[model samples]
Target: MATQTSIPASHDRDFYAWALESANRLRAGNLAGLDLQRIAEEIEGMGRAEKHALASHLKILILHLLKWRYQPTLRSLSWQLSIANARDEIAELLEDSPSLTGKLPEILARRYPAARQGAILETGLPAATFPTGCPLTVEQLLDPEYWT
Candidate 1:
């Protein structure tokens, strides 16, 4: 699908070339030009990206749940679908990285306030009405049977 080219000198200059070069070096057992430091850093960055994604999805899930709870009369199929989708995403993330289970509670706590704010912005609800702290436990939020 594409032409092969010489590896770029620096990873910063061309990331695609850098990755290809790194892989080629590793496969060829040529450690001389292999960027071990940058490769390790990139690996760690990928893990952090996944954690951030989990946090982001958790925030969105809680926001929709708050709206569903606080604005019962305004609930719609879209909100239902959003909650289900978020749960599904969260499950997939946990399945891929089960160590994240230990961080779930703290993540939920950290994201809850922002989620409430989002709920207010989206629903036109006053901030005073929502709980100061998270109302749903992480388990409850993740439970498919919990929402009615």
Candidate 2:
């Protein structure tokens, strides 16, 4: 059995130390000494981080698709590579957290506007050049062979 330290690690002051100590307590079955509230919050934070990662990758894929469709003259291997990479990342995230598949519609709805604005900014094209909303479905956005 691991002995508890006289004082608990401060979560805010030193997060790495707190995490290590928490892990030690858990390994030792010292539930009474565990910081349950902060541990729960940290676990929830991890889930939110995964969700944000999915949204970010979705935005990148959508932005590249918009660029590919609206600015064919400006297309480069960089854009194609980015689109491919985003699809791979999204696939990995879904594999790791299958429940996140249910969140795709919400993620797309929230990320598409940002992606559209990004396309306008990155391409210096008029906002009118891009559609007001995403024209593609999640399936199309993630399709490895779907190039517009």
Highest-scoring model, TM-score: 2
The true-structure Cα RMSD of candidate 1 reads 3.2
Instruction: Give the least accurate 10-residue stretch of model 2, judged by summed lDDT.
Output: 4-13
lDDT of 2 by residue, 11-93 (tens): 98889989998999898999996779889999999999999999999999999999999999989999999999999999999
Q: In model 2, state the lDDT of residue 67.
A: 95
Tell me the lDDT of model 1 at 47.
Answer: 92
Error of 1 at 31 (Å): 2.0
Model 2, stretches more than 4 Å misplaced? 1-7
Residue pairs whose backbone atoms clash in candidate 2: none
